[model samples]
Target chain A: MRTKTLITSMGLFAMLCVVIFGLGVKGLALDETFRRFVLAALWVCTWFAAVVGLNRAAASDRNKSFFSALMLLPFDPALVYLVRLVSTLVWLVITQALLVLLAVPMLKFDFFSQPLMLAVALMADVGILALGVLLASATGRLRGGEALLTIALLPVTVPVFLAATGATEALHTGSGAAEAWPYVLLLGVCDAMFLALGLLLFGKLNEG
Target chain B: MKAKTSNAPLITLALAALGLIGAEVTLYLSYFYTPVQISAGTLYVVTPSSGSTINLYESYRIFFIHLPAAYATALCCTLAAVGGIAWLLTRKDAWQALIVSASEVGLATGAIVLLTGTFWADYAWGSGRIGSGWNWEPRLTTMLILWLAFAALLVLRRAMDTDKQRAMMTAVYGILLGPLYPLVSKAIEIGQTSHPKSFSDLLSAPEIATTKQVATIGILLALVSMVALRYCWNRLGQRMAQERAA
Candidate 1:
């Protein structure tokens, strides 16, 4: 089910946005700042894709198969959250990897030069997917929940977006990893905080 | 029939009245008594246009409202999270009431902070140069994220079909909203921000510091009053909704 949502037009929709973003910028392909722009666009598109994936995943489970089964589980609810997070995270990572691959060659940028950028980006993915899964589950079963998912997910991920983009920019701007560490640390902290909340609250959400 | 919801308890009424008086006094003090401050770092608002600078002279008054609203936002966020956890543990309606009330109030206060903050950024930091100064400063940016989370809580609440679903989602999201408060408060410290870096500069002037503190406390009293009143109304409203559904 998750794969179905991922491969269809919505996935292309996000990828298309990145194409527009890249092509829309005049002379960006030749410019040195192209990599940074590509990173920024990638982050936005990745977030959009993650939100769509999360929403679709939760909607598929809306008949209460997931939660009802959760009720009968022998293990703790937090473990349930972790399991779902990992599943969502895997898909998001794959999508992002595809994006990075596309942007690196099709857009022609040096991603391998600064490996930390990818590290920070993947770390941010965990945070976004962690919170997105929790919120998507909560809103998925309700009427007009799709609208809520988009709106709620967009704004809440701003900090993560900022941190990822900041670190990317800093790394590519000739400052090296030294200037980017603060942002990376902040991103790590946010990721941990969101994951902790997901583990703690997603369980309570399943309880009566 | 819908039950009567506006008859607040005596303590709330008293607090509201006291808050009103305090607000008035704080406004008076901030406006008329606090002298114009020119601290070292805050002394100039450099206009990027002509390479000139200007004193924030009169525009700094917005700080009184800006700071307090931020304080109230943090307070309400904490309240909502605490109430949410309590509700989760006990499954009590009163705890749910507190959760909704604080979320609603927090959204309002967060808006005030954002509005006044942006205005201050344009006028004081930009030196009346429009759209030049604040371009997603870390502090303001993160605070906006926090505000959006509060709004998301409301959206989640409205979307739920059942009361228990609403309560459970709100509790979880409200708790999720907790970490952002610390991030907002520390964003200035941890990174580059367009906001006044530290209160040390603003605190140098005894009168300004005192007035600022008085105004912050005063506004907090008024906002707390609002939160309490809203919590009471929320409890009554929940009961009415449950009755209507039944």
Candidate 2:
């Protein structure tokens, strides 16, 4: 059932992306600047959806999952949080891949040309997933949690978006790997920080 | 049994009075006593036709309050985060009060920072070719983020029904958000943008820095006073709820 839901969700998300970027915006025969702008808009939208979805996922786990209680019985609450974060990251990766697949055919971008950039984008998503899971879990059960989640999430992820965009832009221009790595490195650092923070605080947040 | 009355309101009233007085004194000193050039940094306005150096003169005086307010905001946020951790460990109302109060104060100060900053920017740059008066300079961006995070903390607090749950959740959020302040500072240093190294660069004279420090002390006292008042209010509310229950 979960798998079916996941597949259906991905299909709808892909269709939505195609509607927005593929056909909605003059069928992607846009100038270089406009194309990149559309790409960025899609990037933000993808992550935003991931955050919203993950928040629901985390909340449902807490309220509905039998394993949640079982998992908490073990001394290591961190393991449960790790599992949730990893699962969220996996879902994000799949959705991101689906988005890119739809985007590539419609937008006509050379994916293989910038393998390094693609890796950075994926890692950046991992960072977003870490943040999304932690924050979403932290606020998910509360009233007005969704709005609060977006408010807290967007500002914190500013650096992530900034770095990721810069790196991706560099890659698209076939700029040397040198220009791109700094941004990627920044993303990596942010991801590390988010992951560490999630591990340390997720249990505390979930307790009450 | 009748609940014992808290002296917090009385103390906060006194502190608030003193804070107001100190603020007035600081304003007087900034205007009359401190050197303009020393108090306000060197201001240069760039123009398309010809680049010109412009001194802000009396207009630069905003920094006296602005700088201290900004500092107080950061300090309050730190205190709130620390108080959050302490609250979690001790499971005490006092710590929760500390977190909630400091967060409120932080939000107020953050607003002041943005407000005064806009006016100061207007004086410095808005008058010139750069009419926008607002720039996404790294520091400004980070400060804006800090403000939003704290605001979110307040929203989170409102969402919870029980004090214990609210305290626990907010404390955790506070700690998680705390690192952003220093991290943003570091990121700004690495990814250079147009914010100055320090707002006090114009304070070349020792006397100016001294006056600024004095103003900071005044602002800090005001912040503490406000925090105390807020906590007392929280306590009173809790007591009222208890009384109703009884």
DockQ for candidate 2 = 0.53
| Residue-wise C-alpha lDDT for candidate 1, range A1-208, written one tens digit per residue | 9558665555566467658876788564566666667767777788877886787677778765676677577888788888888887887777777676766766775778988977897899998987888787777777778888887777666667778887888898899999999889879988988888788777677665
Residues A1-208 of candidate 2: C-alpha lDDT, one tens digit per residue:
9799977887677668766665556744567876676568557767766775776685676578644564458556578778877877777777777777777776764555777967787878877777777777756766667777887777667667767876877777667688888889988888888888778777776673
Could you tell me the lDDT of residue B236 within candidate 1?
A: 75
Q: Write the per-residue lDDT of candidate 2 for residues B12-93, one digit (tens) a residue.
A: 8899889878888788888787774522224322221223344666666787788888887888778877887786688776
Error of 1 at B146 (Å): 1.5
TM-score of chain A for the candidates in order shown: 0.87, 0.88
CAPRI classification of candidate 2? medium
lDDT of each residue in B1-246, candidate 1, tens digit only: 223454465568788788878888888988898786555345423332223344576777778888888989999889888987888889888888887888898999999998888877776664534356556667878888888888888887888887678889888877777777777877877555567655554566777788888887788898889899888778778788888989
Q: What DockQ score does model 1 reach against the true complex?
A: 0.63
Error of 2 at B144 (Å): 1.3
